[model samples]
Target: MGRNTRKRRMPLATKIVAGAAALTVGGGGLVWANFYASAHEDHSGHNRTRSAAAQVATIDCPDVGQKIRDVPDRARGEVDGELATMDSQITNAYQRLATTRRAQAGDAQFVQNSILGPLKDRRKAIIDRIQLEINRAGGKADDNLDELAACQGRPADQMQNGDGQNGDGQMDDGQNQGGDGGDGNGVAGPVADDFVDINDVQPNTRDSRNGLAADGDGGSTGTFTTDCGVNENNLFNSDNLIAAPGVDNGAHHTHDYVGNQDNDAFSSDEDLANADTSCQNQGDKSTYYWPVLRLQDGTQEFDANDQGGGAEGNIGKILKPAEAQIRFVGSRQGDVVAMPKFLRIITGDAKSFTNGDANANTSWSCSGFEDRQVTDKYPLCPDGSQVLRTVNFQSCWDGQNIDSANHRDHMAFVQEDGSCANGFQAVPQLQIRLAYDIPTPTVENGQVQNPYAVDSFPEQLHKPITDHNDFINVMDEDLMNEVVDCINRGEDCQ
Candidate 1:
């Protein structure tokens, strides 16, 4: 496929709230709504006779990893293991909560006592161990880490539910009144309100202040493209070597990988360096992977019964991308430098649903309507326009480390002026554009038909805000220098 070298930056919005309804009829045919109400909303003098008590839509836990900024290299292995344990704990808790709805209806405190309370204890111990590891390695652990152990049940009203027709033709009251066919794991999210017609979105201007700056007159405006074929090899896995190394099912969601062939929970830097490449240019052996998009048409995929697949609330037939365009572009401030070997960069957050949009760097839009992008809602593209997922990796390196305790401090995005911050170096920014030809999903009667969603943690409920991408620089030193030189000289090369 031909490549588009034009600069198409993916702008992460401050916050995008897609409207969705979470209505369920529990045992005894009692109608309940998953109303995620505002924190300060008053329920005084309100009539509650007709409605069953509001139910907890999902679990909300503090992202402990995002909070931990410093950990001794010696203790990183222990810390990462503990973090992965926390994730599994959440998953198990969510699974229990999802499967025990009938018992929950009988006892109001079932969720709090049996689920949240026990989960808190488990997480607290995990946090304590994480602290001990840091302290043992001569690094001070954050005292507030223990405070993040408590998790709360998110009320359904907090989720943005649009006023639309319910299954019975009743207008949605922003509360739970309609039924949605969730991924069949009690995590019914990305409902009708989660998808908006692309034509309905207004054309938006690129917010240069929040995105990669456009090429300027004196800057290195050249580009280098690498033809990494779409992952036709079916190289799928649920492991995230960068985030949760040495742990199986670290991601807890399936990912489609291209470029590097040997990527999993156990791959070391040397393993990746020696792996074969899918890129046309054999010199580019870097790994690029992201959560696979699935059409919720009820087709049983290979992982339908597996840990990170249907069993964990990630369902539907996986769709392979038609185009995987990996390109390296010059910085707008000055000449770019070579990215260090084995440098890891993760753009966007996979837990932005409960964690908030502070780290969310998603750009979901239609192929033809790339300018009208969204960070939360999935775009319902027209027949010919394909769904597009584009991300721009951090273009500034801290100059000292290729990896960090949180995997983020080592890399940084360029400032609004297109210059690296003090003590950071400018490097060729990696922009990955993924395109998929998915059938447009239909939303009617507040029910989505053939809904498509990206794989996410069960607690995330398949939110688009949870979309993210990962990359690891494994390019040989010679090729890396050539990439930098090509960009600095303002010449487009392949």
Candidate 2:
């Protein structure tokens, strides 16, 4: 009976169809809701992801930019620091060299006093060593800086290449490729080369004749002679010889006159005794000698007696001869003689003479004489007394020709009568000449060749001993400026 009620029911097929339709509607609704929900949620998550990625990219960009910007500054700082260090090292080397030079100068003084022999070789060695050290320091600094620069990004050709297909093609892996080049780890090159060689230096010496004078007593007359060759003998010999009692005899014997009666009256027995004693001691040796003459009333006269022999015993011998004669003699031993106060004179070779040339043969007219006289050619001495005596032609010309020439080259002396004594205090002067080989590019056999050639004197410097103290000040300023520059540039000074 229930069945009959559902029955008014349509056909079984219709009921089934209605159920199916309802189920289809329900499933479609569920699918639509789920899709809508999912779409909204997906949008939020995507937005967050995009924002995070953007933030990361922005952060990375600034870091990279800052690093790039800092590279140069850091490099500059390092360069400056290296430069400062190099400067200090160079300055120290210079100081050491200067100190050594000063010490050598002191040694020279000792040698002058006969306390030591010449230290020419030692001084030269010291100077050479200092030069070597300076060179080494400069070279090392250059090499180190060169290597640093190469590491920093020099030689652009050495950079690596990434594939074009990749998005990261332009990116660098931050690896250095270049090796040490010329510039130090971004540091500047070494300081300039400035030094003087010792071989070019010159020293001063003197000769005198006043030391050979005889004792001022009528009892005996001492005499000695030098054979400085015919030219020198004629230049210094006297025309008239004087003799007095015992003094005249001694004077005659000293003058090397075997026979002459005019001046023998003034000869003295003491002079003859002294002369004989000198001859006996020398085993009766006889030699030719040149007499030193004095000018009185425009007449040449011999005062001290000198023998014609080059015997060493003749140097301080007293003679009392009863005769006087004028004779010319030639003896090589007389070329160089030394007495208590006098020294023999000889003509030096024109080419060999470091002091004078052949143009002025009268350079030795005065013995042991020092005077300063002003001439149109040479300047007056510093004391304005007489013309300064210069050995070299250039020295004689001095300010007139070479205004830059050293004043010390022309010596100042005190003139007592015709004798010279007491030399003026001299100031130390140094001249430095620098020469080196320069490489040049040339084409040989159709090929480019770099070859070195000796360059002309490239530089010259003059320094006074007093300037040594200023080096410290110069070095300090240099160091401070370098450090300040590095700091301001934001360079890596280390």
Candidate 3:
């Protein structure tokens, strides 16, 4: 119950293993007396043999294992064809996950609605036909569907620990010993162990005097927080949803969008300017978005997908930050420059990140219930506080353009010493800080695993690598000017 419910993507369609003939076709149930469920796993741990005889590979999806060739020669193609279709469906899921950074939350129910749903129904239909063909040919169709779905392979222990082997890849001899973990042979095989304990993965332990300029409200004369507004929990409010604004679900992934409701792939500043809002403030009309991270409770994940939370602390089943802190962080005598309309800006690539080093301008920490804030590895929040993802965008603009060729050229991160680079003029600095009420990542065999997960770029996150954010400014002419003036005058407001 503590794992994120994000399912892995398959570049091709996959199918859940059929649970042996329920024979619900007409009425009565017909039991498969040929095979027993427990026999699916051989006591000797030689699954290859058992797997070879099995029709389904895994419970979650039918493994592309051996084809059933025992059927009459004419019927073999039909069975093979059904499996091929399943593969294609699985591929579609993979494409969705790759582009959108998340899988459908319906789980078995989701499987029933989308491509998986049809796949399963078709598979059942095909199996029924196959059984009929066998009966017509005076043969028996030994059912093995129960075994197929029995081992869905979602458990952490089985995933990291192949079959039942220990960290060394060798079958556990009861000692559970872990050495340098690699086989003595110098083959480029998987390391015996690659995961780190949650406590061992502390990426940020800096006490104070951190290099970030936006770390405090030093010169802020006031702070303005938009309302917790509506939470868009359902995936893809628009066709071009998630990241890649104006592109219409271009990313193919899903995210928890906050702030302005008009934000989308094609939303223009004019759209935000005209849209009504849920926030208490009538002036804040900016749109914000990031991947939805969810915690899985062992067998399944219960998230906003099952409920309604298109608002703060609701979408992705995540609690909203106490307040969204908008600030100006940079030099130039605290003078804030008015942000141009329809400014499209992105910080950190959703599909890219570094576990050992932050490949982007990202920050992480925990607070509220937890005592410490992490800057490196995301905090395994302790006690009351939630983990926070803090991103401070480059405030030094090129003076004329709201965006650059890569959407980054116009702005540059302050120098290592926190000063604007030459030739770049300081503007009303924008800082984005999001907090999540997530527990300390689950500890399984020394590695950190989130109860929920995000769709990120890396093949494997090692930890929770789905932290990212997207923003577009839609402030009104007068309101934009006020934010700039407050920052430029170095007035602190809250």
Q: Each candidate: RMSD to true structure? A: 8.8, 46.3, 17.1
Tens digit of per-residue lDDT, candidate 3, span 1-494: 12113232222222221111111111111111111111233444454223213221112344322223345444433444444444333333322221210122113233235433454565565556656665566556647632322112111122221222322222233122121221111101111132222344434444321225532343333333345343533323321222233232233234556667655545555666787654456676666666545442222223222111110111123333444555544353344456677565666544332222233454566654222433324445566666666666665666776654234555665565444576766555566666666665455542223333443321222133335566667777887777666654555543
Ordered from best to worst lDDT, the candidate numbers read 1, 3, 2
Q: The CA-based lDDT of model 1 is what?
A: 0.74
Per-candidate local distance difference test:
0.74, 0.18, 0.40
- TM-score of every candidate relative to the true structure: 0.85, 0.13, 0.53
Name the candidate, 2 or 3, with the larger lDDT value. 3
Instruction: Between candidates 1 and 2, name the one with more favorable lDDT.
Output: 1
Off-target runs (Cα >4 Å) in candidate 2 are 1-416, 423-494
Put down candidate 2 lDDT per residue, 1-494, tens digits, no spaces.
00001112122322332233223121111000010111112333243222111110000000110111112322322322222222222222221221122232234232222211122222233334333343444422122222211101011111111110112112111121111211101001000111111112222312311111111222112222211122211222111121111111111112222211111222222332233211111221112222211110111113111111110001111222111111111111111111111111121111111112322221111111232111111111122122112221110111121111111222222123212234322111101111111222232332222211110000000001001000000112332333334333333231
Candidate 3 similarity to native, TM-score: 0.53
Off by over 4 Å in 3: 1-211, 214-243, 298-323, 330-334, 353-359, 368-376, 446-450, 457-466
Stronger candidate by TM-score (2 vs 3): 3
* Per-residue lDDT value at 103 in model 1: 61
Q: Of the candidates shown, which would achieve the greatest lDDT relative to the real structure?
A: 1
Error of 3 at 406 (Å): 2.1
lDDT of 1 by residue, 323-395 (tens): 8888998888888878889999988899989998877888888987988878788999999999998788889
Local error of candidate 3 at residue 107 (angstroms): 31
Count of backbone collisions within predicted model 3: 67
